[model samples]
Structure formats: structure tokens, C-alpha cells
Target: MADGRVERGNQTRRAVLARTVDIASVDGLEGLSLGKIATDLGLSKSGVFALFGSKEDLQIATVRAARAVFVERVVQPVQDEPAGLAKVWRLCESWLGYSGRRVFPGGCFFYSVSAEFDSRPGPVHDEIARIRGDWARYIERLLDEARLAGGFREAADPADVRQLAFEVMAMMELANAHSVLHGEAMDYERAARGILTRLRAATAAPEELPERPPAFDFTAGRPSA
Candidate 1:
């Protein structure tokens, strides 16, 4: 009986988390109230609270759930591919797809929460920072691998590539925000093109770059102060 109850509890927890992530992505993490989640899932307030003792716990769990979803839908697909340029391509395509497909109703979960919580210091903010740093490091490592292979110029710095990767991600997030606001997919396509163009330029030998549509340069960053 105890085991059965525990199993049921675990199932309920997962269901709540899955739904919570989607809600938190579309609505800010603070907007993810127990009342709203329970209403969405037809679960009782007490039941939701039982799973997560407090809103902070729920926020942390939601972040973890979103990360798992991202890894499954975005990272795992690329991991199976051989490392170097191919892996980097796969990774980029997967990331764009992950955002474009709306795995969460609002686009990228991290993008939503990071902006919401970046300036606010707390456990939730800390989690967002850690996730962002982890992703940047992952991109840096991938860039390092591609550079070690014949994919990138020996003169290219991994840090520069990482910065480029961050720019691409920022572009996607900016596009997503504008799309959500204006109800159009053009920005998503534009962001994808921007990413691919920079990636090809960075990775391909100068002689090997194919003629394609012109790319936007987000790596230009903020204007000099």
C-alpha cells in the first residue's frame, strides 16, 4: 500500500512538473502560481503543494524539468552524431528546431526565465545563471572540438566562437520574443539564417563557403560606451 501510494505520488509530481514547465515558460516563473497550475491540470491546490512544499521548490523543479526537456529534444539528438563540425551543425539545427517547434508554448524556457530573473538575485536567479553558464561552456567545448579538427581556422579562438554562439542564441530569443508579440515566424527564420551564416563562415574554409543569403551580424554586440 505504501509503495503504491509512493508510485502514485511520483506520477502526480511528474505530471505537475511537465505542465509547470510549460506554464513557467509562457508565463514568468513568478507567474507560475499553484492556483493557476492546479486549475490548468484539474489538480487540487493541496495536491500541488504536497508535491512542492513551497513556490521556490516548485520554481526549482520547473527549471530542472525544462532542462531535461531541452536535453532530450535538443542536446541528445546532437550527441549521437560524431564530434567536430558535424556535431556542431547538428547542435545548432537542434537548438533552432527546439525553439521553432515550441516545445514549451512560449518558445525557449530558459530564454523566458533568464530574462525574467537575471537581474533578481535569489535561488531561482542563481539557477538561471548556472544554466546559462553551462550552455555557454557546452558551446565553447564544441567550438574547441571543431577548431581542433580541420573544421575551423587554427587562428580562430574558442572564446570568440563561444561569444558567437551566445549571439546566435540571443538572436533566437529576440526573434522569439518579437514573434510572440507580433504573431509572425519570419524572425525565427531570420535568426536561424543568422546562426547558420556565422557558423559556416567560422567553420568553413574561405574557399569552401557556399553562396547563400546574406546574414545578420548580432555579434556586433552593444554600442561602445
Candidate 2:
């Protein structure tokens, strides 16, 4: 009986987080309320509240859950590839694929929430900022590894890698924003082209990359979120 109760509680927590992440993506973290969530999912209000304790707690948990999904959908797939300029391309391509596929209703989960809580100083803002920073660092790390491996220019140092990573990420975020706001898929193609151009310019091994970016999925219509 105790085991069954624990399992049920675990399932409920997962269910709540799953709903919260999607809702937060579309409506922003501030849009979430335990009462509304419970009502929407047909769960007891008291039980939902008990699981999350407070609104802030629920938002934080939602961010964490979304991060897990992001890793599974984007980061892990290219993780085993040999570290080089090609791997860098693979990472960007994976990220574009995730956004292109509309893994979340609102597009990139962090992109939506970051705009909402960027100026607000709170636990939620801090959590989002931390994760965003981690992503930047990871990209820089990949670029530096490529440089060390002779895939990128040997003259490029940490600073250059940092700048390159920022530019690359900027292109991607623009694509995500354009897709979410304009409901057009052209930005994905634009981002891919921009990414390839930048990588090709930065690489020491010209033959390591393709002459052009692979085709992006352009069939997705405007996002409802």
C-alpha cells in the first residue's frame, strides 16, 4: 500500500509538471496557478498545492522539467560525435530541429520565459539566467574544443570563441522568435545559412564543413503560442 501511494504521488507530480511546462511556455510563468492547473487537469486543488507548496515553487519546478526535455531533445543527440567543427554544426542543427519541430507549444521554452522574467529579480529569474549562461558556456566549450583540435583557426582564443558562440546563439534565438511571433519558417533557413557561413569563416579546415547548410523544415505554420 505504501509503495502504491508513493507511485501515485510520483505520477501526479509528473503530470502537474508536464502541464505546467506547456502552460508556462504559452502563458508565461506568471500565468500559472495551482487552482487553475488542478481544475484543468481534474485534480484536487489541495493535492496540487500540496505537491508544489507555492506558485514560485511550481514555476521553478517547471523550468527544471523543461531543461530536462531540452537536453533529451537537443543536447544529448550530438553529444557522442567527435569534437570538431562538424560537432558544432551538429549541435546547432539539433537545436534548430528542436525548435523547428515545435517541441513546446510556444517554441523554445526558455526563450519565452526569459522575456517574461529577465528584468525581474527573483528565484525564477535567477534559475533561468543560470541555465541560459550554462548553455552559452557549453557552446563556447565546443568551439574551443574545435579550435584545439585544429578544426577552427589556431589564432582564435577563448575571447574569439565566446564572440562566435554569442553570434551563433543570436542567430538561433532570432529564428525561434521569428517562428513564434511571425509564424514563418524562413528564419530557420536563415539561421542555418548564417550558422554555416560563420562556421565556415571561423574554421581552419575548410573541408570539414559543407558548402551550404542542410535544408530546414519549412512546413511548420505560425505557432499558436
Candidate 3:
């Protein structure tokens, strides 16, 4: 039946997307190829081509797939946290764990791929830009939540807090790149502690600094709403 065919096609599409994200993370989108994907997954060349008519389509699908995995692994976990300084810390912690555990094998997929595609222009590049914008907006929203919670001073601009969030994320990505290249893990831990130090300085009153934990357990599930 045509319906059966459609269902089977959808299954194959999902499988392809799963593999695509992992492969593209390490190899870059341009390095993604039908032959390689098919060979890795043990699928026929025609079958892979049937799901994605061209390489570009496969690349786009890979980005979409990576987005899904990212949300499940990172965003969804922190979505229900009460928005404030706590939520901002939750976001940073989640990202560190996401990278620490090697969720993408090659590290943060967006961080790795975005740099690879930054100067390039196309639908793929557009999608990367959109993802980055979404993340920045989310950080800004967290800063707004902090202001609403009185966690931040009234004079603090949400825009400025968002920029600070980006700096922390950049440090993590830089550490990830170096760690992956050198097989070292200490930088990841240092990056996390450095972020916490900056956040404490930002949020704490002159005499109300928080104590540092020996190790942050970023792997914990999101706090229930």
C-alpha cells in the first residue's frame, strides 16, 4: 500500500537524520556524502538518495536532526526551571554537561559546525544563523527573568547579561575544541568553574557571595516546574 510505503520511508528518513547529525558534527557538512552515510548505516545507495534527493537536502535534514537532539539533551531539561539567576546557571551547567558527556561525539554540534560555515552562505548557513539567534534570544529571556525575580539590579540591562552569557558559551566551545584536539579534559572543568565565578560576581551582593561546589553535577535532570 502507498501508506505502508510512506511509513517505511519515514523510518528510513529518521535513521538517516540520526546518523547525519553525528557524521556532520565531526566531518563538517561539506564532508557529508551519500556514499559514506549509506556505507556507515548499511543502507542501499538508492534508498539513501530516495530519502534525500540531494546532498544539500541531507545537510539540511542533518541540521534539523541535530536541533532535535540538542533540544532533548539541553533545552528541554532547563525549560521548566524558574527563570532567574538560577535558570541562567542551569542553562550554562546543562551546556557544559552536554559537551562533557560527548553528546555529539565530536562535541557541541552547533559550535563546531557554525564556525565551519560562518563565512559560507546558503540555506545551511542561514539555518546556523537562525539557531544562534534563537540561543541568544533564550539567554536574553533568562536575563529578563532574573530582573523580574530581583536577582539582578534594576539598572542591569538584559542585553548586557546576554552578552555575558555568550562569553561563557564561547569559553566552553573554545575549551571543547582544544580538548578534542589534544585529548585533554581539564579545560572543560576550568571553563565551567570560570563561568560560575563570573556569574557569582555578577549576581551576588558585595557581602553575599555563594560558596563554590567542588564539582558541578550538570548531568542532573531539569528541576520539575
Which candidate should be chosen as best, given TM-score against the real structure? 2
Residue 191 shift from truth in candidate 3, angstroms: 1.2
Candidate ranking (TM-score, best to worst): 2, 3, 1
Off by over 4 Å in 2: 218-225
Preferred candidate (lDDT higher): 1 or 3: 3
Residues forming the 10-long window of minimal summed lDDT in candidate 2? 216-225
Error of 3 at 126 (Å): 0.6
Q: Each model's RMSD to truth, in Å? A: 6.8, 3.2, 3.5
Using TM-score as the yardstick, the better of models 2 and 3 is: 2
If both were scored by TM-score, which would come out higher, candidate 1 or candidate 3? 3
Alpha carbon lDDT at 166, candidate 3: 79
Model 3 CA deviation exceeding 4 Å by range: 204-210, 213-225
Report the C-alpha lDDT of model 3 over 1-225, residue by residue, as the tens digit.
999999999998998888888888888888898988889889998999988999988888899889888888888888997766767776776777787667887888998899899999999999988988888787778877776667763467767777787787777788788877886666776886787687776773423333552464434432212
In order of lDDT, best first, we have: 2, 3, 1
The number of clashing residue pairs in model 2 is: 1
The residue pairs in collision within model 3 are: none
